[model samples]
Target: MKLSRDIMRFFIIPVVLLVGIIVTAAFTVFYTTTARTSSGKIISSNWPKEFTHDFSEYINIMNGTPTISDTGKNLLVKNDLWIQILDATGKEVCNYDKPSTVSDTYQPYELLNLYQYGVGQYSVFVSSVNAGDTAYSYLIGFPLSISKVVTYVDTDRYNSGKTLIIMIIILTILLILALTVFYNVVISKSYERIRESLGSIASRTYKPVAGHRFLREIYEGLDTLNHDIALADRQREKDTKAREEWLANITHDLKTPLAPIRGYAELLSETNTDIPFERSRKYGAIILKNTLYAEQLVNDLKLTYQLQSNMLPLKKETLNVTRFVKEVVIDILNAPDLEGRNVSFISNSEAATYFFDPLLFRRAVTNIVVNALAHNDTSTEVSISLDADSGVKLTIADNGNGMTPQELDDLFTRYFRGTSTEIKAEGSGLGMAIAKQIVEAHDGVICAESMQGVGTTITIVLP
Candidate 1:
């Protein structure tokens, strides 16, 4: 059912062959029949000329046949001539007896010497007898024994057969050549259209191919595929736009905290007093905290860039899930910002093993947990758990002011913060993007589920 190029070639050749064969057969039959009919007419036309001079001699020889002796009969039979005579009653009269080897059905009367001896050959004649009340007939036969009329007939038949074969062969070759040229011209145009569409896609011009100009179903199918590719190109462009906007927002957010820190530090350096010293120390501490926050943002951005460019090299090894979770929790708790946040671990197993890049996987999990803590209103209880279903599932559920549908739609995009959220307090939006990159690099998936006024749950399934 699949009409591939090779199959089409196979069918096309046979169709051409069948057409050639039918046409050849018809022409051959017509030619042969016409030739035979014309040859018969030519032979019949010259019959009278060959026989006119032979008839009188044949009749004179048979005059004494009724009383002929055995020796005379032998002489008559030795002449190699065929003769027959009939009586007044229209039946056979005395005549030379043919040899036993002669076939009874031989029609000597129809034979003709269309070729004479050393020039033409066999002669034929027909004679009638006039009886009182009955009519009788005589027939005579002889041969020239020299001419090549038989050879001429044989040659004509041979040439006719040859001509028929040659014409058929020539026609078949021409048909095949014509079909080849037609397919190349038509199919090549379709291929050119496909190549042009691919070039447009490579140049980032996402546009559907025009389908109306196509004449074949194959071309229509190719156009459909082109449309799908165009849709994917458009989607990628939309994602890139969203990423650029998010990155701009993150730059602004990073600059916002740095401005106050720099201003306060400049003021503190101008004087030294108890009140001034305390205020200066506070500003200095705030600057250090915000600087560390900026450093984390830069690190997340670097990781995202490496993942996007396919430059991140992973050192895969088997990791204990329970131990990995514990280490991540300890690290998060030790963070200066989350020192007073409430976190809990709920696990039924002490050992759950999975294969992944330890450094990247740790960064992914850390980002999710930190994101949950940063978004919560007050002292939030975050739960981390792992299950055994051929993978490690990390669930970081939070009791926080959750996100809306539109916010969740752009949740994992780079530097995207939810609506109704403070951009200053929400850390660099690159955390979730970096987490997504790391998870995907490890051949895993991460998803978020949230409802407004309730909470958010971030689930990571690592293989």
Candidate 2:
């Protein structure tokens, strides 16, 4: 509502001023356009000439004299005017209701000034009056209502200054109206497009606004906002789906181990069957293996979130980097699933030392190696190599089922599970992500390179 009020103010202020100017002009023209008589008859600008024309009918000569009829005198009386009739040589021949100030004869320029402004205290009109074959003329005068203005003028300036000013005022009004209309059209169309764009955004069907002159910066900002919102929505949807898959995978992993652990315990609890000692031991081993797998799954979940929240405790200490890494690989291969897999570890410089959380770092390495073994065919070879740069570079490369570009891109996304159908893999789908978090927590960098048909290489550079 506040924004709407501000917008209304912006538009209305200018328009209000425009309207005010028009109203003031209208009143100005209304009042200044003409005068009224004492008898309350409207005496417009054309009245003087019209009265003179109509008075001609009541005028002629009577008995070799230029005389005006009583009706003609009445016309002059109604307007409060005086009159004189002039002969061929511009000499006043007869007069009616004549004022004392007017001359009996006029020079050519005096006659011009009388017609243009009037002689001092009166305003006058002169027109030829045909009186029989004598060809005399008539003069009419009005008493000045205001001080007469004598303007410097020429042939070009001979038009009535009052009429010219009025015409100019009218033209100015029309021009202002034309321009105002044009301005309104431009603003209205831009507003319509802006409104449409906002509506589309609200409905989740947004499109970019087109370029325009008015409010172009605003349009560009909206376009940027539209792009950002679209990106954020897509990322959110992708994250949501990935999280759902992660949850499903975690549930399956928990169930996979539980089923075996429960079955073995039930078998050992049977009293009827004389279970052989070796068989019982084998059952216990299988149960322990499943329990360990389930425990590891839970640990991965706990640690990943801890890393995300910056709550993971890192007990940093100096250790034999090569031996520690090798021990991690050995422990991973010891798993029943990874036993006897073709795995190798190489290091050119084995005496390097680094400070890190050994327990958490071991978990990081195990996750990477186990992931490679669990997903690949038995014929594939895995290699773990450690090298010295400024500190250490540990790489786990595999001639196994390498991932697609999209899979590789999302490899370290916390909830992203592999899309492989080659093996029904176990564990909580967060292995790679957990590995990344642990390495990063140790102030290390981890990245991967892979080709789908050739191989996959996971590299960790630690300081």
Candidate 3:
């Protein structure tokens, strides 16, 4: 239901309003005028009364009526009207400086025509008066001086101008209305689409919305948001399943070793006189071994969780990577468990020193080396190589019982183990996963390559 404000609405309406006001104000200020007539200037609506009053004055002056006075003559003179009296003999008896084009007499129809057509040039006020018992027709004529302003005002052009002005006003209002509708109803639809798209995103629905180029940044940003949201959702689903699997694996792994430890302890603690000291010592050793294993599993799980949660602290120092690998290999070879193992160190770089957390780094390296030694036969050769191109590169390779592609792919997953791990009850699957996490925390990448029967190689690169 939310609507985005279109900037066009802000700009267009003010401009349209300004234009309408200007046009209307111009009409009011420039073209309007007061109306006028022959007797006096007056309002437009009283123009007919003014015209009739002027005509009556002319009639009384031309007829020489008893009510006439100098005031009547002054009225005719001021208005520039003339009067002529004609007898039945067709001779002019009275003249008030009539036009030379004026006839001495006129037929009734001809006079009517002159009244109709000559009104622009003359006002012929005809009246019948008795003089010495004979009837005389008085033709009072007013010379019309056409005012250009008045003529212009009276022309169809004037009305047309008024019509044009009105049309302009109406058109301006309609245009403003049209523009409002276009920007509001038409342009606003884009904002409505954006609103709906946002709602869909909130509800976790994916739908692509097209956007105008004018608002390209908003469109692109929303698209990126949509993509990221989908990716996070997919990752969340994966993490949920992985969490469930990790729990299951941990339960099975703990129970497997605990069962042996408990059984051995029970055997050794039994009140049986038939049990020999040799058998008791062997059972005690088995219990100790299983207890150490369970302890190791718990410690590995704790380390992995700390590393995953970014709580594992690091003590960084510059160490010679080549010498470091060599020292680790020597220690592995010296170990009582890996005494006869064929483990060695090889390097292309002489002294590849880098800053890293040694304790965590050593644990990562030890886990990989221990895994190699524990999985393969004592005759299987294991090598730790160190090299530097741009930075340090360490590789742990073994010619042990190699792994399949699937096992190699899942090697770094938490609680994931290959057939080698299940067969050899040695280390928890969390070792490789923890090692990968620790290496990555130091801004390094760890990769494993393996074949079905050849060997497995774990590579760590640090920048």
Point to the candidate with the largest lDDT: 2
**Model 1, 1-463: lDDT tens per residue?**
3455744664577567667977899878765433112123322334443443434333432443323345544434554555555544334464554334322332333222212321123343445544344444554444322222444457777878998989988897787777866765565566666666667657756366555465566556655766777788777887788778767877787897789778877777666533555776788888887888778778777888899998989998887878888988999899786897888888767777778888888888888887787776556678787775567778889877788898887789876765435645466677788889988887889899999878889988876
Residue-wise C-alpha lDDT for candidate 2, range 278-365, written one tens digit per residue: 9999999999999998998888788889999999779999998888988888888887867899999998777888888998888889
The regions of model 2 sitting more than 4 angstroms off are: 1-6, 12-196, 213-217, 267-279, 334-340, 419-421
Candidate 1 regions exceeding 4 Å error are: 1-159, 177-185, 188-225, 271-275, 309-320, 330-343, 353-359, 379-381, 388-391, 398-406, 419-425, 449-456
Could you list the CA RMSD of all candidates, in the order they appear?
A: 13.4, 12.2, 15.1
The residue pairs in collision within model 1 are: 112-122, 113-122, 113-123, 115-120, 115-121, 116-120, 116-121, 117-144, 118-146, 121-144
**Cα deviation of 181, candidate 1, in Å:** 5.4
Candidate 3 Cα lDDT to native: 0.73
Q: CA shift at 202, candidate 1, in angstroms?
A: 8.0
Sort by lDDT, best first: what order? 2, 3, 1
Q: How close is candidate 3 to the true structure, as a TM-score?
A: 0.56
341-380, model 3: which lDDT tens digit per residue?
7777878877778888888998899988888878777788
User: Each prediction's TM-score against the native?
Assistant: 0.54, 0.57, 0.56
lDDT of each: 0.66, 0.81, 0.73
Ranking by TM-score: 2, 3, 1
Between candidates 1 and 2, name the one with more favorable TM-score: 2
